[model samples]
Target: SSEVQMPMQSGRDYSLGEYFVEVKVGTPGQPFWLVADTGSEFTWFNCHHHKARNKTRTRHGHGHGHAHGHSHGHSNPCEGVFCPHKSLSFETVTCGSKKCRVDLSELFSLSFCPKPSDPCLYDISYADGSSAKGFFGTDTITVDPQNRKHGALTNLTIGCSKSMQNGVNFNQDTGGILGLGYGKDSFVDKAGRQYGAKFSYCLVDHLSHRDISSYLTLGPHHPAKLLGEIKRTELILFPPFYGVNVVGISIGGQMLKIPHHVWDFTAQGGTIIDSGTTLTGLRLQAYEPVLEALTKPLTKVVRVPGDDFGTLDFCFKSEGFDESVVPRFAFHFTGGARFEPPVKSYIIDVAPQVKCIGIMPIAGNSGASVIGNIMQQNHLWEFDFSQNHVAFAPSTCT
Candidate 1:
């Protein structure tokens, strides 16, 4: 694939869309705009559309992400594929005002619409198999005035989902997601075509605690050196969906054999390399060996949380470090190429005096394990479906 030119400025650093900071939402009395999510393109948020709502101050109550006077077991807003004007996550639908409207990508053009009677409902699906219903409309957006990275507005589109994911871990205050992906239909790419290209980002380590400046690098503004120089790693681009490949795994310089499985590629589909995702999920066949590698150190000291997938370390609450051992993961791509994560890449936090078990535990998993951006941060990854391969060139993300 031909290299893309991405422009950059001196002291002022930014790619295309927003990053780091988030905006808060709600009415004047209420604070916050919304946290923008490039991982998601369409924008939507909890609304005030409930008939039982304080119809006086709050306008539309019975909304998307927020449920007022609702029950979980009784009603599910996302019951059907298409929601015209009826859906509630945990609320008893006393009123009829839940519908999806408009395409988020067309939001900017959607404003000052030469037409009025057009429908604005849209259905959005996430990588986790969750869906939401919302409308696309132009609304005023404001970033923190003090923060330069948050203040500058380049190419962005916001959408509000009257409804959103029920049981998930994301900034719920979001009106909706700000998607910056490969599809030409996304708002960021659509609006900033001249400056945008396939999306790219680099995640800082959890330990670095460094400013996680993962910007969406787009357009012809990148450094010429990045384009002129060439470093290519052999990659066999699988189908776009949840395409997970456990080509090979290694621990402490020892190789472990495992089965390979792919993830969903298409929309609401399979797994691919997602820079935005935080954890790297692998299938059971791949999970077992990796988990065993993780458990080897602290079987007696660290309490193992047992489940179908067995003991996996996803803890906000931990007793203490069982052992202070540095681990590694090496992935063998197609051909003779191999990727060995540096100690800093897998370690929990790299700052002085902080040590962590770089591996997580899982009993078994069917969902695709993600090689998230954190894993790819040091490498300049190039995904070219057109060429049937994705290449990675090592870099510090300068």
Candidate 2:
């Protein structure tokens, strides 16, 4: 199968904190900046006719009250939304069809349908408390490859959301979510079934300017420059989540004392690589040590008051600090594979002279940790379902 590629944009310039990719959905292909999420299962779009509440609400997507920093002066932000009727190829899914009954049972429940011919409906509530309810449909979507030859995928299932309530991290300009999770209904799973069970993406730094583009590629096209340096690890199959064996962690080449059960999936803990989440979350056992090691060296910078920094635990004045003052951060996976991201990825620049530690603690005792998009930035990650392994290597993402 030929490679299909799309350029990805960072949301910082738009005052949004997530990363986005322009997708051409439906016939004659309408463009939308869909948030690229690997943690979600179903792909969905916003309906044009629905209206968002005309009030300013603070977002807590990153586990804190972090606003978008800019106001969109409009009465109804959903005015010029995606018009589903305009797409000639769009068709609603039947309530009792095989696609709705078995294939998409995770999203479209059979109990929701009263009659066989009724439209299949879906109501999903995310982990962040945001909700979206809508009917299911199928449409043709165009795929853009670098060679200028456009390919169309037909009868692809999607959710045409009638209402979407804002959550902790959703950008107002985001038309929908591009689901790249492990579920059967996801774009990655469906597209991979026909094209190839291999997909890859290179995420640019979260704070990169709009002009600098990252990329998401679908197929066996691994960049020639990074093949030799790429490291491979087994992907622990946990439905809808890509789990990895995170054995240990290191700070400036010194390994920290994180518990074994914290990394054990069969026990009380495990780690998943999630693109939907904005900040990395570690279990309390892992986070305490990481926080101590990272902060123990910074004696020169003054710590900001806890109340002033929102939910972010450690914020310091960036006046006298450079990248050299912080130790290098790396994640050591099973089989000796270590992923060392740039210092800027974790020590994020939130304001003019304020830098905060981007990692957050997992809320509960579930012992799950998330390696969010910020930590994965500037690295080309490839998921090969056929081989049941994921590969990664540092790259410029040019």
Candidate 3:
């Protein structure tokens, strides 16, 4: 079985809303910071206009490592480093290819293709009205091994994005997004095929200083085994997303009386584990009960007067407010998996001297609930795809 270990650094963006990871691509390995998104399936990066001359060099065991030699250094403020076309092993998929005709159409629109022999181009539109247009290609992606020896995953499918529209800006030190979703083309699925379908990650606190770091390990070298008393839950198989049966949520040991349909997977209403989302999102059916249970107890404390900030609903004044008043939340999943997130995970600091309940309510009744990255902070999450199970354990994540 293929096994690889890579260190993961987690930090808040300028808006303090998203988490991203640094990835090295191309031959000489140009490092690019990308959003680690479990909700998406396509890995893409911004491209530049300037081209570079290829010069072969050896770094890791792979001899294909080559650095780009260029003098007319025109830089892009958004992309930073352009795709080293000449130095990297790259190929564009044709529009008539099996991958483009079948798998690509599931996540992206293929209407832009002018000819069947042309490159398989795609346009991915997000719920936030942001979009990315690009063509599919395969290349090498290098990951810095913990032991200092260079490691790489070769011939990986990636998106060579040509343009971004609307809110899809790469200004926050982010080159693109690393898709870890369950789709066939996603990084997790592609790597899982060789790595025995197992992967794990330890997430640090969202509010933690930038100096702190974490780990995202693939295959058998999981870190959760060292943490002790692992709680296992069945990983509900939902294509293109990691779904789990979140039976109910309990606050301070009291189980909230939520409707059964709120947790029904057959109804297209269930919980998924997503790293891209910053806050937990529960369907309106479930969110109301959870919000009532959490807010009813906090009435004695001073409430901050503010309108809904972005997706957040419950905001409170942080001045002289004791966080101990907030209760611990435990998520009960199928197969006896119980996740008890620390108080800081749910009640989060959004601004200076202001904290808010980090859970958001999905407007519609048919949408799936999301267990966002914020709720998984300071914990080890192990995805055992081969065994169809996911294990979790509390951890410092450093």
Of the candidates numbered 1 and 2, which has the greater TM-score value? 2
Model 3 shows how many backbone clashes?
Answer: 0
lDDT tens readout by residue for model 3, 244-316? 8988899888998888888888987888898877779898978888888888778866676546466677788
For model 2, residues 56-173, the per-residue Cα lDDT tens digits are 5432233122123224443433344666766789888988888778777787444577889887888887776777888889887665633265755678788888777888767445
How displaced is residue 193 in candidate 1, in Å? Answer: 4.1
Kindly report the root-mean-square deviation of model 3 from the true structure over all alpha carbons. Answer: 5.2
**Model 1 CA lDDT for position 29:** 17
lDDT tens digits, residue span 281-355, model 1: 565566567767755754445333323222225222134553345466677655545666565555433223443
Better of 1 and 2 by lDDT: 2
Each prediction's TM-score versus the true structure: 0.54, 0.87, 0.87
RMSD of each: 11.3, 8.6, 5.2
Which parts of model 1 have CA positions greater than 4 angstroms off?
A: 1-118, 123-131, 138-158, 188-193, 207-214, 220-246, 261-271, 298-301, 304-324, 343-367, 373-398
Model 3 TM-score?
A: 0.87
